[model samples]
Target: MLELKTPQEIAAMRTTGAFIAELLDDLQARAAVGVNLLDLEYRARALIEDRGAVSCYWDYAPSFGRGPFRNVICLSVNDAVLHGLPHDYTLRDGDLLSMDIAVSIDGWVADSARSLIVGTPRPQDQRLIEATERALEAAIAAALPGGRLGDISAAIGAVADEYGYPVNTDFGGHGLGRTMHEDPHVSNRGRAGRGLVLRPGLTLALEPWFAQGTSKIVYDPDGWTLRSADGSRTAHSEHTIAVTEGAPQVLTRSLTGAGLP
Candidate 1:
C-alpha cells in the first residue's frame, strides 16, 4: 500500500523512535562479558512495560517464523545476524552481539538494530561492524524525497561491495507505521533507478547486514535464529528514517546524535 505519514503522524513516530533509541542504548550498556542473554531480554521487557510500549516481536507470527514470537527483543550473537531468540547463554569476552528491537508507542512504531563487541573487540570484527554501519549511513543518505527505493538499496550494496562483504537480500528492510512491517519491501541490493518512488512523509526501516564469508544464511532448529551459512562472523546496522523535502530525517538515533557524524 506504500503508506505515507501525515505531519502529525510523523511527529508521533519520532517520539516512538526516541524511546527506542534510549532503550537500545540502555540495553547495550547493560550487556557485557559474563552477562546472561536472558537478562538483557528481561531488561527490555521491563523498560517497555514501564513506558507502556508494545513489543512488535511478541505474538508476532509470520510465514517463515516457527510460531508467535515470545520475546520483546532479538539478541543475535557471533555468526548470528537476525531473528535471534534470547536463551540462557552467557556472554564471553570478544563475543559479537547484535541487538534488534521494535516497539509501538501511542500507535506509532519504530525499529532499529546495532552490533557490538561484549568486552575486548577483535580487529576483524570491528571492521565488519564498521562496514555495516557505513552501509547504513549510505542508505540513509540515499533516502531522499523523489528518490527511487532502489537508490537506498544500491547505496547499501555499494558500501558492502567496497568492504568486500557479501550481502543477503532475503531478509532486509521494510516500511513500518502502526504495525512493524508494511508495503514496499526494501532490499540490501538493487538498481539505483528502480522500484517505488520516494515521497515526503515516507517512512522506512533501512538495514544493511553482511557476512564475512558467503552470502548464504542458515536457520537454527528453534526456527527463530538465523546465522551465517559458513559460520563466518556477521554484522548488521539499521535505523528508521523519514523522507522529507530536504535531507532524510533519521528518527531512530539517540538524543546524543549517535548515528553518522
Candidate 2:
C-alpha cells in the first residue's frame, strides 16, 4: 500500500534524514586512500549509536541477499554498484567507491547513497559519477504534486541516455518511511507521465545508478555485492525527498546550508 506521511511523521523523518545526511558526509570525508571499508562501517555504527538511532541494514534479511546483513552501511568499490557488503579491502588511488546507508530515528527512516573517487579520480570514472548526480538532481526536480512517478524515472533515464550509459532496472529507487522499503517502486527507466500520480506528503528515495559499459550486473559470491557484469565501472547517487507544493523537500540533504534546502 502507498502510504502518505502525515506532517508529524514527515517531521520525524526529517530528523532521521538529517542524521543520515551528516553521517554520509562524514564517511565521505573519511574514505581516503588507505582507509579500509570495515573501518568506515565501524565509524557509521558508532555514529548511529551516538544519535540513539538504528541501522536499517542491520539484520536485514532480504529475499535476494544472504541472511542477516549485519552491517551498518554498504560500501561498494569500482565495478560494484549496489547492495555491497563491506569487507577488509583498503581504498586505493582513483578507486570509485559508493556508500549507502539507511537509519531510523524515533521509528522514522531515511535512506541515501553517494559515489565518489578515493584519492585522485580517473576522467571516465568522474564523468560516470557526475552522470548519476545529474540524474538524481533531475529526478528530484520532477517529484511534484500533480505529476506522475514516471516523470522522475524519465528524468533519470534521460540523463543516463545523454551520458550514453545503460540502466539496469533490477534495483532502483523506492518509497520508504517507518520501514526501509515501501510501495511504488521507482524504476531508473520509464516513460514520462506514467505510473502512480505524485502528491504532497509522498516521500520517496530517488536513486540513479549506471554502469559505464553494460546494463547487466552480476552478483558476487557473497550474495550481496552487485557489480557490473562486463567488468565496467559504476556509480550511484540518491536522495530521500518529499513532494511539496513548490520544490521537493530533500530530507537527506543538509537543511542549514546554501547547498541544501
Candidate 3:
C-alpha cells in the first residue's frame, strides 16, 4: 500500500535526511586513497551510534540479497555499482567509489547515495558521475505535486540518454517513509506522464545509476554486490525527496547545499 506522510511525519523525515546528508559528506571526505572499505563501514557505524540512529542496512535481508546485510554502508568500487558489500579491500588512487546509506532517526528513514573518485580522476569516470548527478537533480525537480511518477523516471532517463548511458531498470527508486523501501517503484526509464499520480506528502528515494558500456549486470558471489557485465565503470546518485504544493523538498541536501555528484 502507498503511504503518504503527514506534514508532521515529513518534518521528522527532514531531520533524518539532514543527518544522512551530513554523514555522507563526512564519509565522502574520509574516503581517500589507501582507505579500507571496511573502515568506511566502521566509521558509518560509529556515526550512527553517536547519533543514536539505526542502520537500515545492518539487518536488511531483501529477497535478492544473500542474507542479513551486516554492513552499515555500501562500498561500490569502480566496476561495482549497487548493493556493494564492504570487504577487505583498500582504495587506490583513481578508483571510482560509490557509497549508499540509509538510517532511521526517531522512527523516520532517509536514504541516499553518492559516487566519487578517490584521487586522480579519469575523464570518463568524471563524466559518468556527473551524468548520474544531473539525472538525480532532474528526477528531484520532477517530484512536484500534480506530477506523475513517470515524470521523475522520464527526467532521469533523459539525462542518461543525453550522456549516451543505458538505463538499468532492474532496480530503481522506491517510496520511502517510516520504512527504508515502500510502494510506487520508480524506474530509471519510463514515459513522462504515466504511473502513479503525484501528490503532497508523497516521499520517494530517487536514484539514477548507469554504466559506461552496457546495461547488463552480474551479481557477485557474495550475493550482495552488483557489477557491470562488461567490466565498465558505473556511477549512482540518489536523494530523498517529498512532493509539496510547489517545488519538491530535497531532504537529503547538506547544510551548504552540497548534494550527490
Candidate 3 segments exceeding 4 Å error: 256-261
Tell me the alpha-carbon RMSD of every candidate.
2.6, 2.2, 2.3
Q: So what's the TM-score on candidate 2?
A: 0.97
lDDT of 2 by residue, 1-261 (tens): 899998788888998888888888888889999999999999999899988999999999989897889999999999999999999999999999999999999999999999999999899999999999999999999999999999999999999999999999989999999899998899999999899999898999999999999999999999999999999999999889998777899899766543211
Steric clash pairs (candidate 2): none
Show model 1 residue runs off by greater than 4 Å. 256-261
Off by over 4 Å in 2: 257-261
Model 2 residue 140 distance off true place after TM-score fit, in angstroms: 0.5
Scored by lDDT, model 1 comes in at: 0.92
Report the C-alpha lDDT of model 1 over 1-261, residue by residue, as the tens digit. Answer: 878999889889998898889888888888888999999999999989999999999999998889899999999999999999999999999999999999999999999999999999999999999999999999999999888999999999999999899889899999999899998799999999998999998999998999999899999998989999999999889999999999999898776645211
lDDT of 3: 0.93
- Residue 113 C-alpha lDDT in model 3: 96
Error of 1 at 178 (Å): 1.1
How many angstroms is residue 234 displaced in model 3 relative to the true structure, after the best TM-score fit?
0.5
* lDDT by residue (tens digit), candidate 3, 1-261: 899998899989988888889888888889999999998898899889999999999889988988899999999999999999999999999999999999999999999999999999999999999999999999998888888999999999999999999988999999999899999899999999898999999999999999999999999999999999999999999999999889999888765555323
